[model samples]
Target chain A: MTSSTTESEFGESRESDSDNPSVTKVARSKLSIALAAVFCLSVIMGTGPGVLLVNRPESISGIPLVYAWGILWYFVQVAVVIVASLTVWRSTGVAESCRTHNAPSRPERNSAERGEGELPR
Target chain B: MTIPILVVLIYLGVLLLFGWLGYRRGERSEEDYYLAGRGQGWFISAMTIMATFFSSFALLGAPGMVYREGLVFALVSLNVPIAGVAIYLLGNPIRRAGKRGGYITQADMLCDHYGDGVGLRLLVALVGFLFAIPYVMMQLKAGGELAAVLFSGYDHAFEAGAIVLSVITALYIMIGGMRSVAWTDALQCALLVMGMALGGISLVVSMGGPSAFLHEVNQLPTSSLTVPGNTGFWQLPMLFTVCLLMPIGGIIQPAQWMRFYSARDADTLRRSALIFSVLLTGCFIFAIMPIGLGGQVMYPLELSADGVAPNERVGSFDQILVVMLDDLMPRLLGEVAGATLSSLVIVAIMAAAMSTADSNLHALSALFTRDIYSRFLRRGCSEREKLWSGQLLIFVATAFSLVLVLIGSRPESSLSGLMQMIVTLALFAVAFSIQLLPMTLDVLFIGRGTRNAAIISLSCGLLVAFCFTPLFPLLFAKESSPLILWINAAKELIPMHASAWGLVVNGLVFVAVSVIESRVLKARSV
Candidate 1:
């Protein structure tokens, strides 16, 4: 059962890679890693908008300069969406799917004996 | 009774219908009772994840925080991507471990490694329930207040709210169980997002457009948006801490872990985490910041006979959003919108609270039945009896929280203050189990440490967190000055902004004890 699954998975990967050119389902670069790092840093280095407020301390009439804090903040938000979309989009089955290929003999047999196993769901 | 009553009843009745449908599958086996028979798919997992993630804390607390703090409060949410990554990193392995062991709680993963029997699992689950009750009460508090506020000038509004919310939630939870919670969450989440957007728009429009509101608010001293005192005194360290650690605290949450257990595979968990990350990001960034900013712009002052600014309530920041609703929305539409928003906020909060609560309650019950009860009370009891014990525990836990709610009500304290105090109990409780952080890292990568060592480290970590709570106060009093205390106290007292130095202490002890255990094991082996 496990061997047959691997053969099919290999078959699927070959068929898909030939058909689709835009799918690279893994984070495999200094650039990608750097971008991921930068994204994470902005979140962790949550220095208040004070520094930004200092640079643009003057709000005209009633508008707080921080109102457009979105310009900075949303960029970070979109950056995350970009990275996430990239990661999931690329790795449809590339890095290695979770292991479900073993001949379920050991677990099924063991549980049958214990009366506690229900096929590991 | 009224159209509003009909809407609420239909809403709740539909929920019961869903729950009944789910219960139709049967719950005779442990598979059905605990993990939804482990048949949950990507969509259910995602919906459950979103619902639980976007709960009352986001709905009410986000806006309330904005009311108290400024637009800056929403900044804490920026951590989601990172938190998503952290959870993706942590939750995946934990999910894998759970799939391997049929372990349902966060402590299940921990206990399996630590060999501390159920002691560690019991500790984590018990803490989860303790922290959960108050957070649940906060939702109940919001739902009840919103009901009373909407039904203003009506008799028995408060009593009506309590009855309506509790009965509705209880019926759905009891009937539908976990599946009901997840499905209702999906429908409710969609409504919640739309309602928040509409309300935000209405507030902006009613405040005389962004132009006018901004113009008026710009006239106030800059200190208005900044904290009460100047010198960036209270907030500098606060933003960094709350924004950082709370997301980290989220990683250890057993309720959140339960969502992982329900997922079909690693791929589904990954996708769900990714989707929810976006949802959570949008939620935090939009939900409260706009409300906080709106409060500043819209509700300038109450009029006096002489037309001077009357003495405004100093700390009632949460009421700003409500006031804005009254000002921006017309009498009736405002009421409907408010009611809808209230429903979303209440369910979201309750969902978050309940998802976390039920998972924790189960974990606690497991400790009694699987760990403590079976160990002592009735050895080798039938699996069916053990399952019932878990259900009984859930009822007891719900009752305990109801008691906590009654107790929480009579106390003369600020809402934000109470939220901080209660959440602190949760953070402090779980902070100890963080020994698992390093342990988790090792297991996923290095494969180090014995079960005994893990337990000792976790216990010591718990101790240090408790010690710091009292120690910090004594330390503050002896400093012969109140500046640091005042600054720290500001965060500690407010629910969203509490000082997290205890978390730091907790982390350090957990690490130290784990290291101690690791080295001791190495030496003995040599």
Candidate 2:
């Protein structure tokens, strides 16, 4: 299953080398690792022990202290997601080309990748 | 009859116009109708996504909760940001898969990944329907409640309002489907934000300024300003459970899942996450929080003799913002201007409800058409037959929802009890939606689970979730099942939400079942 499926199977053509399945796989795996790390960090900061940091009885700038703390993290998350989307998710020339071309050749590629229209067993 | 009613009428007219426009642009193809040809830009996608996510719950329910519970409800608002993160982490990959697979619904990708087992497709469709109907009902109830208050003098106003809103919403979606839904949602999102900001600002100015508002809030009891909050319902354990699970559930629900499939590319969704996070946080803090805290000051909680504060509630907690808008806008702006602004706020409330309802209804239609009807009722139906079937289901769902809303609007209906029941059902829907998460993770990112594992794990997870719900108790003869005692014990021990508890079982069963199935398959191959 692992060999059969790779990030290249999902139309993420980074480095203009979508033709090279091996390179696309390596890039996608690295992107996956980076996303995983960010996700873990968000979980920690947004909900886990990070919640403890805001579970308090105070106020800042007239807002409840805890609410103020939560808002700060909210901004941090917004920054992080924007950074990730611009950088890690679309990090190559092929991605740039795909966007520019509006992915005109997507339907044929998608059908080939998905193997739809199969007879029901 | 009134200014607010007129404003709402005008708003409805604009929505119809958008529907007509969408109808003009729509093609006969399924993808064109369901996903707007998957060419949405960042702004439209962001606004539509945000609009669909907010619902009447954000506009009406959250502030009311804050009024009842205090700042802890504000903490719960942080869940919006977590959902934004989910959009980035979960949605981006899903979009990639969607693009690769030409997927239109949650079941489409899942059935493709696991091979089209009829049972798997049906289960996914059932979950989507169950999750969607309550949400549609919630928004319908909201519309009725808005009408009930805004046109208090008229008899049967609530039912009339609910029926009207339902018909109009269903009509628009029927006219142009997802295109009309998304385009109208973008406009509704803008109005929602502005309305919230206007309400907050109106209150602040009426009370002097932000500092004065804060000073008033500071004068309130210390309990209202801290964790554990008003009646102690926002205790850490419950808060932790809600903050963790509900956001993820909110994001991964069927409507949102389809939104992931509709994105033009990763950049559109990425930009959407950024916009959504900022807009929600701003509206939550600067707009929503003030109405709640201001309500506490305006209508202080009633106390008992012992002063234990048995419940964190006020007579009309849910109506605080609406009531405040009615009162403050008039005093602050005077006659014509005040009435106009109030009318706009009322329209905004309607927008909030309608945006959520349309998305849920649209997703439900797609789920029925693609997953169930095509699979069983008519396997080789033309695109026209499928489209018409999906369109018919919208009215079916809406009519059923309207009947429930009317029944709940009766004088004998316990408004508080009904609200509580609706809330519980809605939460239960989310719990069921979250069960799809493990399977989704497996299909999109991790390719480990087998077909049998997906089917069994989903069944077990949904069953466990149902058992943990409050509905489980009602199912018994005396409303006191054996499960009640165990649920009570579990709550006493951990104070966790049913969604959280269900998820523990869900993950464990999913991983365990997958391992067993995988081992069996390996042995068979050997």
Candidate 3:
């Protein structure tokens, strides 16, 4: 099974230099974060207060003049996610990491890596 | 009685068919039995995630919530697509870390930060499965009740579900390992999408427009719509937080994380998440929400007729969506939609159940094979012994869960509420763990701390959630005389609403404890 282990199978393995984290990279990341924030905001804006804003006779659950409150709740939800994205992006602190212990032996790793997966370009 | 019994038998037969197919294909190698050799493609992987995520709750329960609540409740399900996006964003980190650390379970990621294997996996599994049991029962109970209503209340519907569901999942997981599970999941996802989309639109069109229904809803008093009722201040915030956090809860579930290993590559995992996030969430919400709202509009009088609340009815709030569709709609559409939704719902529910169950079953098998049985029970076991032992353990654990289901599950229980509770609490646990920033700090920065401290922090967070959020209220709040009413009222508050704020409390304790422990460890090293 250990017949193949091509280098290309690995995608930019986590070996980035961070000591002087590049400004351009940081700027690029922030842009991505802002884009995501905008996307989430758009969805929330599109759906959150739909009926609430219209002052329709039919309430969310028949309560008078209350759909606006539900819509407001969605606004807050959108704000929170947007904040988290911005905060996480600003810190450049690593996103949480995954770790496995009790290593399943070198031979096992070799066997598990038996077949290389080809990723599309 | 005979027909119900036959219906159960037929259902069980379907389960057995899947199970037998799996077990027959079982291989001797561990990888074959565990991860389907990780040869799964994007389609299967995506289905596995969607199917696992979709579950019976989405099929019957989420819509039920929407039925009982409103489209506002649809926000609770909005996290569906977010899960796929989250996976895409987080997949590289997860896969990379898994590669570096050789992590198997969801706990590994956190354990990576804590720099230890000590009980993190077990703590995760125990808490998750503990919450999961009620959910498992909800599915079985929903399946049973649905059958009972449709087939005239067969006494053995759940037992049949247990036979069908438990056996099929165990067999596939046991036989094809992750491969069969993923492939089956893809098909399950397809069925779910088709079933829910067609079933939902059909139900909605037949019911007439939602706008017509809302007209009646607006006439109710302000307070009823405000806090303490449907869309109160505390409700949406807590619900939104809960729903938003639901995607991250996947961070802890071993079933979803196992996909980390199952993906063809990190890219495949990302793509699957993005694709599924767009597709499944919409189909699932659309499928169930409209039907639920349709019921909310058309069937309220019947639901609220008795002195009891609408959610506490005999069949179940979750089953109400199906009931409304089956009973009120045109007969042929009802039957076809019923069967389609049921099959879709069944597969989705099964996929959700097994996505966790198979993962749980396999992880437990691995934990036993790698962590416990092989480590302590019998040292120097052979390869075949490990393989067979893993299979045997999966069988035993699954059987045990079924037994637990039979014992723990009550036909009279609230399926919709129980389903929500499990997913809700799982988020609480995960969110709570994020609180132990000290543990995170310790591992990433090599801050001095022992595995014991990290382990305790996990335990502490879990303990706080169980003690304050749920058990305390159940034990004390309802026991007192005047206090009982207040306690019931208090259950609606933010912290009490699914113990939404418990995550905050959990974080504080973990970080404080970890920081203190880190200082102590530093002094010792010095």
Candidate 4:
């Protein structure tokens, strides 16, 4: 059941790139990796120890250095989210696929049956 | 007085009307009521998510922290965007799982993943209850605080305000369910954004605009402009841990977990992630941050031997924003306009409080009904029966939180000792919710945790987190006990937030137990 669900969710993406599945797969994988890297970097610089480097009394453009540091990282994080949303999250046929493949056949009748097991990987 | 009262009444009436509309539009199914048929759009999803993520904490507590702590909280505000990022990274998968499996509560999805056991379900539900009640109490307390300021001349204004807010919020969720809650959240989100912008602008203008405001802020004591802040609370380790964990903790709490379930699709959450990060961060940075700095410049805290305290004009740290609006709006904009603007901003603050209260109450109802009542109390209950039970739970939970808030509000009451800044309550609540994080990540991504592991780990996490809360000594430990002394020393040495501490223990326990359980199962099979 889990394998079937996974197949259905990713099946459309495969079909959309059937002409060159390997290239598209590699590209998507690379983009996801890059996005994750950027996100991690932003978190480190924005809120982690990177903040200590800039935590000072001095002002940047009249804003406190730490605050200005936060704002810069905020934009970086926002950019990462936007790029990921438009690229990796933008599946070819997710809405239709999710509806057909993901929707329960009927309302779950019992607690044991409801949310029956782990999600498709 | 008339203007503020009138404004509150009108705002509340609209919220009730939305609740009624949601009732009229809703189907009688449990999913329809609890998850809004899992069809919330990007706009409503984003707004409701934002509105729920922020609470009076955003308006009152955050600025209060900034006012008291200085620029330190401005850095703390960065947590909002991290939460935004989580919406897509964490939320999308959760949504996909929820849609596929027809899950309504956090416990449902989690129990499903860990292979449902009564103990695991109960523990998960307990976590939800613990998170919801304190959070609900905080929102109710905000209402009381607002009323005390807005209706200062009236006797028992605080009590009246809290009761009204609680009753109204409960009624709406009881009537409209998720639809009404989400719609009202949308309107409240708009009001909150407007209020933040307007409040910031008024403060800046009153200080003679941007340059003058910056100059005044710059002139504040060096402590107010640097790390550890005015009170020395936000040390580097504390700030780093809080910024790292609080948002993750906030995003996985019961109310937000259901929001992920309610989202229409992956795209809805994807869009919500972007909007949430961009719009909320903008509001916090531009609008909310200034209010705190301006508060320091306008109404400076008293520096005493004990520590810095709020100015005489300000009743408490949380009251700083309300006091600023009351004093500045009237003085800056003339009598009629200032009062009107003040009323609107007050309503916005109330909106922030109500939006959160309604979501938690609604989510609590679902948690009780789906996770506990139907499963344990009455198996195979009708959909209508479950729905009715959920609604009743909302009313009962609201009353319970109201009573707790009222008790805490009393000066002589022991519970009053527990009540501090709104942010403190928020962090306390988040500590409990953060216990779910290790399990949630495993269920969503890692898929290695056992049911026994989840239960044991969550219990340990909750215990450790509770020890860090202010209520620990009040309830269990004597003030002078070796245990209390050691805990305090540990806290002072580490300086991490309660949520981080809990997550650290929770994550470690979860991994260790899972590994051990897996090994045991493998040996038995062999």
Candidate 5:
């Protein structure tokens, strides 16, 4: 396998993305950090010790409190994922990267160019 | 009986058709066969990932757990979303690495990142082998259990059911590889979701709808409504740790890891994550959770000196769902209509089993062919030869797991203790798989871990986890041994899942080894 080119190229691309601090790059980083914060907080509240607050026989709108707590966290997690996908993931310039890295070597360049094969690396 | 059998036969035929289609569309390259050319769309990716993530664990095992433990499993259900978050967080990076490095299995990326070494590659493959076998065994066991419940009085029904499931799953994966597995998973995922929703609804309706159902649930014993449950097993610490770790372990397992590599793009995985989190979690909370709770209200456990056991009418806790469907459906919806829906749900349960079985079998084949056979046994094997070897491995692995499941199915067999609950097998598998977490994180993000650190930490973790498994004592010591007694005592005191224990030791060792290795390298440089 062409192991060296693959690892070095990927490593270099990742490093360069961090080194060149353009406005979009900085914003993307901030969004990613913020998104991570929300995700972590949600996990803590959703499944962690936060569950103790609702681990009871009491009902909310006729649903059991613990079950309701879980459902609430599920929605929070979904929102964080949706926000990350739309903002951070969408703006990662994955399409451009795919075109630069995969298009030249792959037989399916047309599809890559159309953003159908635009993966992270 | 005839209608349900007809439904199952039809379902099996559709699966074979999908397998043939995958073969016709596939290229002969190993990449195409193993990773589906790394070009799956969001829909197939989402469904396949969810289907493979779930398994008999979702349909039979989870409900069985809820029936056995109560509302504690409800909270454990939250682990689904954490797994969803992992798909994008861990998956995108892994996909990027796989695409860039032309990697196929978990061993590929890990070996490349840690500076490829034979020891590291073999250990990584060992993790995959250890994790996949028990998981595959559970799915096959689920098939036999389903048959035993459905076929009731038939001779050798359990054996026939398990063999059919193993043969069908192995044949498709052999014929079409990853493409067939993913395509069949898509169909199976759909069936599984429908089955969960319909099963929940049927149970609710049988108890006279939502308000009546909730009222009946509220009237049950307090043990059934709270944590530590009826059996007093899922205490707070155990629930929290298992909920936190198991999903991460599940996502990083061999099958799901390859699914990330198989995705068309980051966007496909992102969307897949969203769908998996929202849709599947919804199914769990609304659809699957009820089956177990409803089973309690419908069948009600018999509290004995041996602790809480399933009602006399219920064959076993895992059989609760099928038994409830058999008893309740015909009474509520009349014979023909009820039987049809029941058959569909039963096939859905089989789909859940097959979807997971095919993915794990397909992944195990890749691990063997790419990491072991081609790399060591045949240094310069042809692509055709590699593919053929992988197919052969799938058949052999399936048969091996089938034999284990058959043996364990016998009540007199010693292995029956390990096969008690589908959830127990799932946890046992994850204990090994979660051992991959620390090394995977270091390789993907931290980048400070040495090759030696990875190997040492992984070996330590696997050993620790193995010592905790039910099989460990069975193989090595009598239950009365001092070592076995101490281990059980520690487990009781800690109350965390076996995987959590493995991961704890794995993380600590990894950090210690990586720190010392780094310092030594720094001193050498100075």
Candidate 6:
């Protein structure tokens, strides 16, 4: 029963400056904001008031209109994620920020002391 | 019954073996116990997330709802993808914050961001615990109901099944911690997907073929084929509210929150999101929908104006999938193969239940130890002590859930279907969990509001949510509660889901209080 009081175990460094917010970072943030806003509106439109328009007895591809509309958005959401991940999210360097070995593995802990939860090497 | 029981027993044995392996691999630290040292690969992470998200509700409650309501609940099924979108949008930010802040539990992250002084830690922990309990209880109920069906005519079979499933899930989670939970969840996810696809296919083929199956469904009442659906329970407004709010509740809950923290990397989560949004969830909606619709044709319901009126003839809607598989699979596949396939499907359903149960119990133990006992009762307790405390809480929580299941299972129990009650309880859990949404958004994205606003908003939100729930009336004797009458009047006028009502109140209060408090602080400084 021991408490790991060392700051290293927590993966926090008061001195580290990984997230140096820059103009590019701000632009990326704005893009993320725009994407989030669009996503929310899509959800509301597709699932909310949109249900009224498509709530019909008509069939397309043998599927009812409402069910068809619902399924359409399922694909749309996936496409949204793909577009965001590939375009806006990739260039932000957040993926690189994610590679830091924050958790203490048995061998890794004993082997070295490096910055954790941050870019490696 | 014998074959299915044997198959399930074998499945349980394999889970136990995984648990033992998890124990061997586990280290003596909270990181290893709770987050699996954050080293899960993309595939494993994807499967675990999918499995934990689905649970018995997807297999049982969902199909039952579809069978009862028709196309309306199918739209409800679309919420899974909405949750997938939430994972991609909300999950990455939370993961980034979790890594940066070194937070494990939901409370850990929230308390870290908002400052723990104004009771943010305890409030988040309480909401999480409230959500986890009913979620765990429902999974336990699914186990018992599955057993009662498989072992019909056996006395105390339901109780035995519930207890056994609880013990096995708890043992594995306690032994290996998150590592075992994740690994077993992967196994469970595979079994779940295979079972759903195979089961759906078997269902379709038994009735003839795809065309024949579609013909049968099309011949049903037009209400079943349209929106507002057969039951009319999913009216446009209610449907809108449920579709919008429910997925938020589903993703932001405690277990899913921790999964975001435990991911190996952003790439892993992105792939996981792909599987979640497209592959797994897509398969689920496609596969399970046909089986449920087929159930309607097999056992036709008498439709009144609103929808399929509740008829005692059909018995429990929850048992539709189970009953259909039992009767149809044998006739379609041939005797031995049908029995074996049906047995595997039954085990898959059980796997769904166990996967969710283990996750919630594991999360509860973490929340109790880290957020409550360690934080308030004794700060700086050793990691080993906290782990042991968590293990102990798992047993206590399981026992409490078992008592509730037994009471619900009784002959003269006031509650209806065990599955239905479980579903209600899970929604109640979500009602409270959704209260955390504003706080979550504030922490993850907006970065506004003080601790006082969080505490007050959550408190008022839970109050409004409780009042809107059926429990509020029942607690006060439904006929005797004047407040119930008043609320009923209001509900009739508005026609909104309880969770939606709660969210509105919660959002308004959070914004108002935050604005007022911030202005007060500004004026004082001036």
Model 5 docking grade: incorrect
Model 2 C-alpha lDDT per residue in residues B172-191, reported as the tens digit of each score:
99998888999999999999
For candidate 1, report its TM-score.
Answer: 0.79
Give fnat for candidates 1, 2 and onward, in order.
Answer: 0.18, 0.30, 0.09, 0.33, 0.30, 0.26
Per-prediction interface RMSD?
A: 6.1, 5.6, 10.0, 5.7, 7.6, 8.6
What C-alpha lDDT, on a 0 to 100 scale, does residue A99 get in candidate 1?
35
- Write candidate 5's Cα lDDT for A1-121 as tens digits: 1111212322333222333447657788888998889878877776677777876787777777776787787778778788887777754535334345643322122224445444211
Using TM-score, give the best candidate's number: 4
Per-residue lDDT over B1-526 for candidate 3, one digit per residue giving the tens place of the 0 to 100 score: 3433444455445544555565566565665566665556667777777776666656665665555555555555556655655665555445555555555555544544443354764665465455444444444444554554554456776567666667766776676555556656665566666657765776656645555545544543333333333434234455555555556555435566667656666546655765665566556545665666566555662323242235333265556755664554435455544455444444444444445555556666665665555645788888789878878977887777667556545545332222333333344334443333444344434445556666676566555555444434444445556755554465555334333344555555656776787798789999
CA lDDT for candidate 2: 0.77
Question: Considering every candidate listed, which one attains the maximal lDDT?
Answer: 5
Q: lDDT score, residue B348, model 2?
A: 86
Q: After superposition, how far is residue B149 of candidate 5 from its true place, in Å?
A: 1.1
Answer with 5 or 6, whichever has the higher TM-score.
5
- How good is the docking of model 1, as DockQ? 0.22
Minimum summed lDDT over a 10-residue window in model 4 chain A is located at: A1-10
Off by over 4 Å in 2: A1-56, A60-62, A92-121, B305-315, B409-418, B421-426, B475-479
Q: Report the Cα lDDT for residue B481, model 6.
A: 71
Could you give the candidate ranking by DockQ, starting with the highest?
A: 4, 2, 1, 5, 6, 3
Model 3 segments more than 4 A misplaced: A1-27, A39-121, B1-27, B107-121, B209-234, B301-308, B311-314, B328-356, B408-450, B469-502, B521-526
Residue B115 alpha-carbon offset, candidate 1, angstroms: 1.7
Candidate number that wins on DockQ, 1 or 6: 1
Off by over 4 Å in 4: A1-19, A92-121
Candidate 5 chain B — worst ten consecutive residues by lDDT sum? B108-117
Q: Provide per-model DockQ scores.
A: 0.22, 0.24, 0.11, 0.28, 0.19, 0.16
